[model samples]
Target: MREPHRTDSATATRDTRPVPCRPADARRTVRHAVAERCRDRALTCAGQALDDALLVTSELTTNAILHGGGITGFDVAVDSGGVRVSVSDRSDDVPVATARPDEPDRCAAGGRGWPIVCRLARDVRVACLPCGGKCITAVVPLR
Candidate 1:
């Protein structure tokens, strides 16, 4: 997981629902749905940025399973600028996006998730709930 990106709060609204992405398969499906629903909602912002949004969702969900202890639930929201995806897990460790310069090969895996999310999302945020959990969110812009 990575640190949530930043964007002005004045232009976006929160739209979230419960989803299960603890399992690898479920996470994949959720990622797909983030793009699908975003497009279906007629949120024009999603059309051009769906791929980045999907990638961001995938990373967040994957982090939830690996670091957050497990994906208890998740949600998706969209605004004029782009789509917002949120994943809630059991842990409170805030994810920080870091740049790894050692890996010259851009195709390498393992440490790119957070960096990717930060790059793709217009804004990313993480909030800790009182009940031992946290929600990581990302907003991807349209074309």
Candidate 2:
């Protein structure tokens, strides 16, 4: 398991420094980090929260790769409130949740990541970096 960089301070408990973007393995890396942090915090890893967290992580990372112009940073933090997963990319395009199709189309091959993230996460935020990028953060409650 590759360890992501860390920043320990008095106020913040567990915050990852920032993992470089690797689209192919971004989902796997973020999921692993989330699980490890949950375990470290003594949170149940086999519960629905964990499952939702992993699914949200995958959706966010996939969006970053496909629509955000490649991922530039990734971070996962676990605390009393909940688990927060942040994915940054070069593109400043904000993610919008698209409505589900009225009818099942066999040829439909894309769209749905944002809605899944919104549904799974308790809160979602998008912050524009001063440097010229944006970071999307999603928080999932342990309970």
Per-candidate TM-scores read 0.68, 0.76
Q: How would you encode candidate 1's per-residue C-alpha lDDT over 21-139 as one tens digit per residue?
A: 44445445545555564455655543446667677778888888888888886766555656667778899888875677866887876787788888888777888877878987777
lDDT, residue 50, model 2: 71
Q: What is the lDDT of residue 2 in candidate 1?
A: 40
lDDT of 2 by residue, 1-143 (tens): 12232445432245454575554365566556656665666666557887787788888887888888878888777665566788888887788866657447746766877888899899888888777778888888878
- Supply the global lDDT for candidate 2: 0.71
Residue runs of model 2 more than 4 Å from their true location after superposition: 1-24, 38-41, 100-103
Among the numbered candidates, top lDDT falls to 2
In TM-score terms, candidate 2 sits at: 0.76
Query: Which one wins on TM-score?
Result: 2
Q: CA lDDT of each candidate?
A: 0.68, 0.71
What is the alpha-carbon lDDT for the whole of candidate 1?
0.68
Which pairs clash inside model 1?
3-97, 4-124, 5-124
TM-score of 1: 0.68
